[model samples]
Target: MSTQPAPASRPFSIMPPPPPPVPLPVRARSFALVGTFTASVFLSAFLLFLVQPMFGKMVLPLLGGSPAVWNTCMLFFQAALLGGYLYAHLSTQKLGVRAQVGLHVGLLAVTALLLPISVAGRSPEGSDAPIPWLLGTMLLTVGPPFFVLAGTGPLLQRWFAHSGHRNAADPYPLYAASNLGSMLSLFAYPALMEPRMRLAGQSAAWAMGFGALALLIAGAAAWVWRPVPPSAERADAVPADAPALSHSRTSVPWRERGIWTFLAFVPSAMLLALTTYITTDLSPVPLLWVLPLALYLLTFTLAFARRPPLPHEHMLWLQPPVLMVVVLLLLSGFVEEAVAAIPVHLAGLFVTGMVCHGELARRRPAVRHLTEFYLWISVGGVLGGIFNVLVAPVVFNNVYEYALSIGLACLARPWPQERRGWRGQAMMAVRTVAVTAALLYIGANSKDMNPGLLMASAAALMLLLTLALARTPLWLALCLGTVMMYSTVKAIREPGVLLAERSFYGRFKVVEFGIIERFHVLRHGSTLHGAQSLRNPRDPITYYLPHGPVGQIFAATAPRAGRRKVAVVGLGTGTTAAYARAGEEWTFYEIDPHVVRMATDRRYFTYLPDSPAKTRIELGDARLSLARASEPKYDMIVLDAFSSDAIPVHLLTREAMGTYLDRLAPGGVIAIHISNRYLDLEPVVAALVRERGLAARVSSGPDGKRKRYESIATWITVARTEEDLVIVAADRRWKPLTDRRVPPWTDDYSSLLSVFEW
Candidate 1:
């Protein structure tokens, strides 16, 4: 061999030197790949959330700013998100990776074409189908864009799994990042976007951001497409007999999918129901809306995090007691206290969401099945949303969805899946039947019993159930049912349903009760809007009492020349119509068609029918309808447009005041009902009138023991000058409102936080 090599005497090596060790091609740095996918997920989330509130605000004027408008919007978003997740799941599983990338990129590009979102087709004008119209309008406006946006997180994560990044094995942490983006965007909408920019400006800026997200997503896809070494590719292939990494390749059991869906459903439904509860019972201020949603997103952020600070077991254990308190508060009317109730409801929502979302995170499958997991979650969200916004309203009379959601949340606990022995199972069945019978009995007999005693008894039973039957799924379900029965029992026990109506506005329960059961009351949420003593239908009761500010306003304007034209904003039982004299022109501007119907129905409320004045009801937002009314000016304009306990924020803004003034005749007085359990609206009205260079007086209704129909009312009376409100000005009982430290609310801005009464 040596001689041969010598003979050859060629080049450098004796014996064939090892072929030049093939230099391995350097891999593109993985840091950029991971960051690119995360950033893409974040941006997509931000744009999606920013567009939600932006578009919701843009359409608010058309829908009269009802909380129901937000509810309907949430439903549409959930449905769209479900579609997006489904698309992601299908594309990832059914299509090749390259096709998935191409399809998603194409979708994003097409969605961009519909950017700078605006409502298409005029808002439903004079149509009774506001919900249908809302759904249709939202479907046309942001539907495609949102669907595309919704797919971004799951789709990008799926791509990241195959991108060969160091952390590609688990993509769950990326979900936390996505929710963080959503939380930031949600916070920014009210604080940064809405306050500083108009809808058009917000939309344009959002479109620009969306375009940026598209580029990041494309970058992520490119990273996924980068070529890999043959060894790495071979290593990635699992042997046919190799065990899956935590069940990565195994088909997700139907039961596991069901658990994911049920867990996801609880949180989504609770989010909507809690929003409605807070906004409806406290104030439908943007602050209230943002708070609940912020908390909701926070749960997702925490649950899907890389290292969850709170364990799923901890959340599961913490939820039941909090949930019990929540159901009790809801049933016992403890939520009437906004200060106490708001926090209680929020706490309940947080704990419940944490348990549900945390379990979802715990049970999350490997990156291989990431898209499917997300798809099931989205499905659950959509179903929950539909139940709240559609099914509940259609099937039940009250906001029973809220109570039902609590029950569902309790059942969502991750308990033992395997059944106990027949004896144990049989015992659980017997307990379940016993609990059911008890619930039915409670539902039937809770009426006429002491609330304190009933609540005590229910609490005791819940404790017993949790102790004896907590380990069994059937028993857990029974416990949930028992809680629901407790809530429903209270509603059913309440006397007299003149009209149990649901509308885009909210639930209206026209209940009857009092000495000899002579009074018919209009209640929305837990607040009483009006009450009419069947014996005294014409005598204004509650806030409309003869000696109250509302009464004084009407009495002062009673002697006006020509027809005493009176325009009232909120129709709440049409009690203001009772102030109308014979032959006077009375027009009611009502946003809720149900309220109009309730007020006009002689059997329900006779204030509209018993009015001495000729009455005409205009159906639409009061502000919009007032703008369109080119009528003879009214001597007295009553802005009693509060819904239950919520202020129609749109109606109280400075622009809204100007509208009222424009419709007012010379020397006409504008009376605003400012009485609220949770807000000191006197300052708001004071600041507004002061800005307008008008004289304002606030009358605080009697503070002594309230009569059966009488409540403590606060009214702000603003007039062109002191001369117009001579009677109110002269009366010492009506104090002058001099506090103008707070800024007046405008169409662009209002701070419920600033004026929030503790």
Candidate 2:
């Protein structure tokens, strides 16, 4: 290559002469750009997270009672994010600066065409298997905006890198600023935007921001781009239209691209795992998904800060041991819900993040390839998000996202290899052998395990002092030590003591919270069954309490009136199955493996009285299960299959309703619980009914204990045929639900947000 004086010293080509120096110091400009970008990030991502919970809340009513769909949507989002990242990469690679700007603006214009981005239709034709299709619909509806929004981080960073005005030494700080903005968004949106702004207002505000973004993006592009100068471009500077280079430093800390991949994988997986764990154990408050994400976003903030971050001290000291213990414990299922274990979980993540991010900073590429390096990081993240969200659900029946997270966490942290001398090796070899023997002995006898002893023994002997006296390969010793420590068996294989239960298209496993922390059970994903209420496992009334709503509805439609057949859509722990009387025939439909086990395996459902109806558990999708049932059979149909935000919108479609009505006996009552924190589902119910010319009413607030429940769930009871339900009968407690009848939803008409906060 010919000598081109420094890139900073000469023009690239036929580009215009550089503008005279402006009054703003380059430092100030850098700060403003970073700060404004950060602020924009907060605004953009805040809406992103805010909308996730809010929209989920909006649609909860339409999908049968399944919270698992939330996870499904999250998976979809991650997949789309990857798609967006790949798109950004492709755009930057194929287009010149001017074209790239034009392409982005064009995408913005197309996305704007989808404005007032509210779901307005009802009656999805293919709702027979609606989860996947509705997912596609929502994504297409929201894609244009999100795609442009996603390009912000990568595109802006690229712009700053090639600006040719500031010290290129640290344009990376802008990335940190971006995450900071995003973190603030995660916190502010739920706490502020949603609870306050109506959907139209929210949509309007986002549209305004989009317009401003377009203007800023145009301005920024105009500030930096120019035709290449023939002399300098001829000399050896990169072409004005050169592809972003993917280069690495010689002494990059991890050295392997695989390690970077591992680094990227662990944090994202942890975020998802913690989100699931909390939703499972603590709460599925869709908005709570934000907490782990906030922590993750904030980690990027600290790791990529302008200087040594706040985590440096804690990272150097406590993060290692905490990470080690948490990894071992998590791998062993000692601290299952990273959500319930927030204090320790956050601490471990914080420490591990410090080391991990510090390494990322340490190994950062030369300023020339900074943008490309981040591109790879985002690529890895998108991959992780895909694995956790897109692939995991179809693969495992139970929540194993947490297990993968533990493995990745360990992978992110390297071993302390300094002590791997000679004797240290011998000690490790002996320890490995001893631990193997102990494991074998325990396995042979098949008895109690002393997890504490095994862990302590490994820690005591593997400490650096012992290693100093002994020559060993520290990496190998630690590897064996990790195996030995991780090998310790758990005291209890099953954590939750079964309580009041129901199963939906989600997992409703509740654990004994314990004194000082009273135990409360929560559901996380889609399971076509029910839950175990800790409300005296011996008490069936909590679920099918003869004094409850089902009990009351059955009473009002008195046996004297005629024979009343019943169809319970979800048979979780089969709590509702107990509500069946001698003359009354009931069919229970359940769809999860774990739920089937909990209900009839003799391990969990000991409270149910043995009878012909007790054995009537049907395993499959509730809609399918109900569709297969005899038509015109049941007087009371309970729609509790989807009870959380991760819901399948198909169950509430007009076609599903037609199916329910076709299957219902005259004067039937359908009880649907619409309790959710993030979405306003009543509107969806209203839309569905309005489409069908049916009447409805709602019952809000907790049935009994609110704190024990965490979030309040609503019940929107509907009728297939008209009969006076002057009062709702709930467990000898006759609480009056809404009396103002609402409309029935039809396939040609259902919009969840349509009935929200109007």
Candidate 3:
């Protein structure tokens, strides 16, 4: 097989392609392609992100109007993208440019059939395997669309290279431009797109632009043959003896396949983890999820720009340990509730990303090899996707991707220059001893060690670690780093102890807000899953609150032994189980194993009365559990699966309602917590009731002992019998919920802006 083919020989170019093995013009067209290719990449990248928030809004309701739905979808998308990149690499290495374009165009055509984005019907699903179902539906629904878009950056880089663009301006700055486009999409979705457009309008707009992109892609293919012809000597070409480009003179660093995997795996994992940390801590909106990422992309732009290099390029050095500290915080129950707690985590994530991207950019080959360079980045990206979305859930409890990513980051990182002297060795000994002693002292002390004081100790130890890393043996520092890191997580991660963190495809961590105050934070990617009081000793008033949806449902109906087969979808401190009355049967369908352990563990959910009554906990998706319940006819069904931003949307579709109604007594009430920070859920509830022929009403107001942080919440109760809903909301305050005032979120139709208060 020949390395190069003249276009005439290939039958496409107006002029004959260059002779066999025509060399890339490393300097000539490099500047020109930077602008045009950058613009093209920019446009495509812009559209790629724009669609995320747009489509997220469309499907908000079927997933319970929980912002977590979007985050989960993000995980799916990232995984699909990895698939796309893999396909691109395998096909393009041997396929000619014309064939690549032809193949990519075919994919675009196939995906175009999915345009004018719309979901079938909006209702939660009844499936024991909602996550897998959700993942499958999302991948199938958007796969073709995503695969074609995902190939843009790499393909354009190839085109720029084939144009024989030979300059420092070649592919790198275009990459900066490409990311700038990504930044715009991240920023624009929340600030501009959603606020201004409806789901249909947004979909239409994206579709229009996608049509344009297809044309531009075709145009780009047409332009690849300009300025050179097959078998012709180009007089403007520089001889091989000419000075090489400045950026091209640097030696290529040796790369192992594992190293490439590390680069990709570390940053992408950190990205998803940060997505979890922020969405869990901050508000759930496209804005929240996109902000830190924008910062990350901006770092790439600044790092590669002519701007003076700050201490940024080396920030990755401290990341592994930083990651360890964050993980330890998760383990130790140290997360604070304030928004301020989020920025530090975001900063750490940004630092990790910067180091990875900066290293990639720094080691990038000359423009001649731009195609190959991006191919590796894509490789790293794809591996990261698999590691985070596909592998992490099965490999560890909770999202340890952050810690794992940090570990890999260290492995991929360039080692520090070694110094062999007594001072160095002595300093090493002091640092090593200090970290070890701290670990032992803190670990063994148990109850005596105050977490705050311990945190301070950890910080001091990390600072010492960083300082030592700067001057000592890399291996010794890393050794201490790993141990200290593990110790920190052990101290903080009370997974099965005081804090009952559910481990799975989520982050459900409980951190001590104060000595006697524990705050349980739940997460789905970058969104908060849920939070509630970790009742001290026996404070059932705040924890049990006889008026909350579940509390009211069970307390009112349980004493009568009215509903023996009650099913609760989510397990939150098992507070709902506190309403258990004698002879009443209750089963909780919870997905996270950590949450199950926390619920069943003697240390947590004590009020739940371990093995009390007929209460049973089922481990699986709530929808599936509900669907399988044949005629035990639950007198009360609580849909708690949409706990927080970690929304599993496939659980809440029109089809899902049929499953629940089928298992309900004629008058049984289904109270859905329509509480969300992003999407206005009332409209979706209204639409569901409208289509399913059920009566629904909105219940509101904070009935609990209000605190400084009493969040205003709303609920929608749908019933087979209309009177039951009124009975549930009778003593409650309610405002008329209108179709226009709220977003009519369906499985196929949801938008945050439709209901967001300006």
Q: In TM-score terms, which candidate is top? A: 1
1-758 per-residue lDDT for model 2 (tens digits): 22222222111123233322112123324555544444554455554554565455444444543455566666666666666666766766676556776777678677778875666564356445768665876677666677667676666665554554344334566667767767876666555665456555666676777677666666566544644222211111232211111123222234445556667777776677667656665444544566677778887888777675474434544443454444444444444354445666666666656656655654455443444556567667877777766666656445555655654554554444344578856766676566434433433332245767665643653353223322222433354344434443332235554432333333455455466544344334422123334445544433344444455555666752334577777665566655555556777776676566666654445444443342366666677657655654777778766544533455776678787888876667777755454556666666667667676666544356533323334566777434445444333343334322333443323334333433
| Top candidate by lDDT | 1
**Residue 719's lDDT in candidate 1:** 93
lDDT of 1 at 525: 67
TM, every model: 0.82, 0.68, 0.70
Quantify all predictions' global Cα lDDT against the true fold.
0.75, 0.54, 0.58
Runs in model 2 lying further than 4 Å from the true structure: 1-68, 91-99, 128-132, 135-139, 197-201, 226-255, 282-286, 311-314, 324-340, 390-404, 414-419, 427-542, 545-562, 581-634, 639-758
Better of 1 and 3 by TM-score: 1
Clashes of each: 0, 75, 46
lDDT of 1 by residue, 440-462 (tens): 55544555568898878677756
